[model samples]
Target: MMRRLLTLPLIGCLGACSLTPALQRPPAPVPASFPVASAVPASAPASAVPASALGWRAMFGDPRLQRLIDLALENNRDLRLATLNVQAARARSNIEGAASLPTVGLDATHSRERTLATDATSRELDRQTGVNVALSAFELDLFGRVRTLSEAAFARYLASEQGRDAAQIALVGAVADAYFTQRLADEQLRLSERTLTDWRQSLELARLLKQAEQNSSLDVAQAEGQVALAEADVEGRRRALAEADNALQLLVGSELPGDLPPAVSLERQPVIARLPAGLPADLLLTRPDLRQAEQMLVAANADVGAARAAFFPQISLTASFGYASASLGSLFDPAREVWRFAPQISQPLFQGGRLRAELRLAEVRKSEAVAQYERAIQVAFREVADALAGTATFDRQIEAQRRAVSATQRSLELSELRYRAGLDGRLDLLDAQRQLYASRQALLDLRRAEIANRVALYKALGGGLHADSDDAAAAPTESRG
Candidate 1:
C-alpha cells in the first residue's frame, strides 16, 4: 500500500514533465513604422533628446510652477485613485501567485455519539473525537496553466503601475496649464482696469468741455460709451479669473489658499530644451500608455494559452496525516495514527463548448488589445504634431499681435492729438481706444496659447512623470492608503 501510494505522486510528476515540451507561445504582431512628417529638417537628428530627460521642471523652469506641480502630485484626487489601483493590482497579482502553491491547514474536532445495536454477540454504544492536518486540492500543473496565469497577472499589475505614472504626468500638465491661464487672465484684468481708469478721466474732461459749450453732447455720449465698454471688459476678465482659479483648485483636489501663489508670467518664454528633430520607432517603447497597452495584450495572449490548456485533463493531489481516537485524551496515541493520499484526474468529455468559446474570446480580446495599442501610438503622434503646429503658429501670431498693439497705440495717440487740436471727432479717438483694447486682449490670448502648447508638447513626449530608479525605489514603500 505504501509503494502504491508513493507511485501515484511519481505518475503525476511524470505527467507534468511530459507537458513541458509541448508549451508554445503565440506570435506577437509586428507593428508598422511610424510615419514621419516631411517638414522635419534633415539636419535635426531624431535622437537629440530622450523622453525621460524632459522633466517638467526643466520645461517650465519657474519655481512657483514647480511648487504647484509638487502639491498636485501629492494631493490630486485622480492621482490618488490611480495609485490605489496600482496597489490593488499588486495585491491581485500576489493572490494569483499564491494560487499556484499548495495550501496546508490544521483542523481539530471533538464529538460524542451514542448508538445502540443488538447483535448476536453483544450490544454497544460508541463515541469519537479527532484531529486532522492536511494539504488539499494541490493541483499538479501538467500544462503550465498556473505559470501562464501568474504571467498574465504580473503583466496586468505592471500595466496598472504604468497607468499610475501616466495619470501623474497628465495631472502635472493640467496644473501647469491652469496656472498659466490664471496668469493670463490676471494680466488681462489689470490692463482692462487701467483702460477703464483712463476712460473715466476722459469722461470727466468731456463733461467739462460740454459745460463750456466747446464739445457737443455726442462727444460726452461717446466718452461715456467707452467707459462702459472698459467696465464690461473688466467684469468679464474678473469672471474669467475666478473660473481659472476654480479650475486650478480642482486640479489640486482642494481649495486654494486665500493668498495663493501668484501665476507665472506666460509673457516670458519658458525655457524648454530642444526636442528630438526626428523620432525613432523605438522611442515610443517607454511611453506609459503604450507599455500599458502592450501588457494588456500580453495578458490576453497568456489567457489564450491558459484556455487552450484547459481542454486537457486536470490532475490534483490531496494528502493528510493525522491522529484520531474515541476520546480526546487518546487522540495522540500511537495506535490512533492515520494517513491518506489521493490522486485525481478529470477530463472534460462535454461542456457545451465552453472551453472552446473561452479560447476564442481570449483571441478576440488579444486582437482588440493590439488595435488599441496601435491607436494609442497614433494618438500620441497626432498630439505631438498638434502641439508643434500650435507652438509654431502662436509664435508668429504673438509677433503680429505685438505689432498690431504698437500700431493701435500710435493711432490712439494721433487720434487724441487730433481731437484736442479740433482736427478729428471724438468718435475717431474712441475707435482707436477700442482697437488698442482688442489688440491687448488678443496678445494675452496668444501668450496663453503658447504656454499651453509647451505643456502639451511635454505631455506628448511622455515627459514630466517618469518612472526613474527613484520612482521604482519609492514604489514599494509608498502605501496606497
Candidate 2:
C-alpha cells in the first residue's frame, strides 16, 4: 500500500512539471540605439567587443596598477563577502532542489515499563523495540508548487552571482580611479614646489631693487605672500596624495606594498584601449546589475506560480517498514516484522483570505522586479551617455588648455626680462608669474579629467568581455589603445 501510494505522486511530478508558467524575458524599455555623441577617437569602426571582453590587464598598461587590481580582487573584504554570498545562495538552491525527493532516515524506538505489585499482584514488565528506515512527510509536487519554489531559488542563485560580478566591476573602477588621483596629486605637488622656489627668488630680487630705490617695500610683501601661498598649496597637495593612498589601501585591504611602483602622472598615463562607445544600448545586456535584476524578476515569476499552487491540494507520504520484537533475541525475526504507511492530502478551505493575499503579494513582487530591471538599464544608459559626451569635450578642453599654458609661459619670461631692464614694474612681473602658474594648474586638471573620463567610459561599457561562468578564470585577454 505504501509503495502504491508513493508511486502516484512521483508519476504526477513527472507529468505536471510543466504546470508552472513558462518563463519569457520582458522586452527592454530603452531605445534601439545608444545616443553616442562621438566615440573616443572612434577612428576605428565600432567593434562588437564588450567592455567585459576587455580584461583589466589590457586597460591598465602599468604593471604596478595591474598588481594593485589583482590584490584588490583577492583581499578586498567586500568582494570576498560577495563571493561567499554567492556560495550561500548556491546552498539555498540546493536545499530547495532537494525538496522534490523524499527524506529517508533511520529511526529507532525502544521502551520498557514496569507496574509495581498492587494489592498482592506480582510485578510485571513490558519491553518494546523497533528500528526502521522511514520516509517522512515528503510533498508530492503534483502541481509544481515545490518545484516552482526550487526554480525560484535557482534563479536567486544566478542573481547573486551577477551581483558579485557587479561588485567586482565597481571595485576595479574605484581602484583605478584612486590610482590616477594619487599620481595627479604627486604631479601637482611637484608643480607647487617649483613655483615656491620661483616665488622666493622673486622676493629676494624685490628686496634688492627696493634697497637700490628701484622697487617699493609693497613689492617685497607681495612676493613674500606669493611664496607663502605656494608653500600652502604644496601642503594641500600632500594631504590629497595621502588620502588617495589611504583609499587605495582600504580597497586593497592592506597598506600598498613598498616594492610596487607608483602610477605615472596624469599626462603620462598610457591610453591602452580605444573603447567602442558606439555599441547599441542592447550592450547593457552585458551589465551585471541589469542581469541581476532580470534574474530577480524571473525568481519573482516563479514565486507567483508557487503562490498560485497554494490554493490547490498538497499531497504528502509517510512510510516505515522494519522489525519489532518483545524479546532481544528475536529482534530480527521475520515473524516480528512491523510496517506502516500513510498518505495525506490537504486543501485549503478558508484562511481569512490568506491564500488570495499571498498570490497577490507574489504578483506585486514580480511587478517590483520588473521596475527595478528597467531602472538599472536606464541608469546604465545615462552613465554611458555622460561618459561619451565628457570624453569628446575633454579632448577639446585639454587642447585649449595646453595652448593657454604655452601663451602664459611666454608672457612670464618676457615680463621678467622687461622688469630687469626697468621697462616694467615688479607688479607686472608678479601678475605674469601668477597667470602662468594658474594656467599650468588648469591644464593639469583638464588632463586629469580626460583620463578619468576614459576610465568612466570603460566602466560604463560593462568593464569589457569576461569569460562565461564556466571558464572565467581561464579566459583569454584582449584590448588595445
Question: Would you estimate the TM-scores of all the predictions?
Answer: 0.84, 0.90
Cα error, residue 109 of model 2, in Å, equals 3.6
Model 1: CA > 4 A from native: 1-51, 114-127, 258-262, 269-273, 277-283, 327-334, 466-481
* C-alpha lDDT values of all predictions: 0.76, 0.80
Q: Kindly report which residue stretches of model 2 are placed more than 4 angstroms away from their true locations once superposed.
A: 1-24, 39-49, 117-120, 281-284, 464-481
- Tell me the tens digit of each residue's lDDT in model 1 across 1-481: 9999999898678445422122232322333433343443333223235544555666676777777777788789899999999999999899889988999999888776655566546556577777888989888887767777887898899889889988887898899888888889889999999999989999999999999999999999999988988888899999999999899889987766655455466666454624552453443554677678777877877787788778888888899989989877888999999889998999999999898998889888877877887777777777777776764466567788999999999999999999899999989998998899889888888878877876787777777774242443343322110
lDDT: worst 10-residue window of model 1: 18-27
Question: What is candidate 1's local distance difference test score?
Answer: 0.76
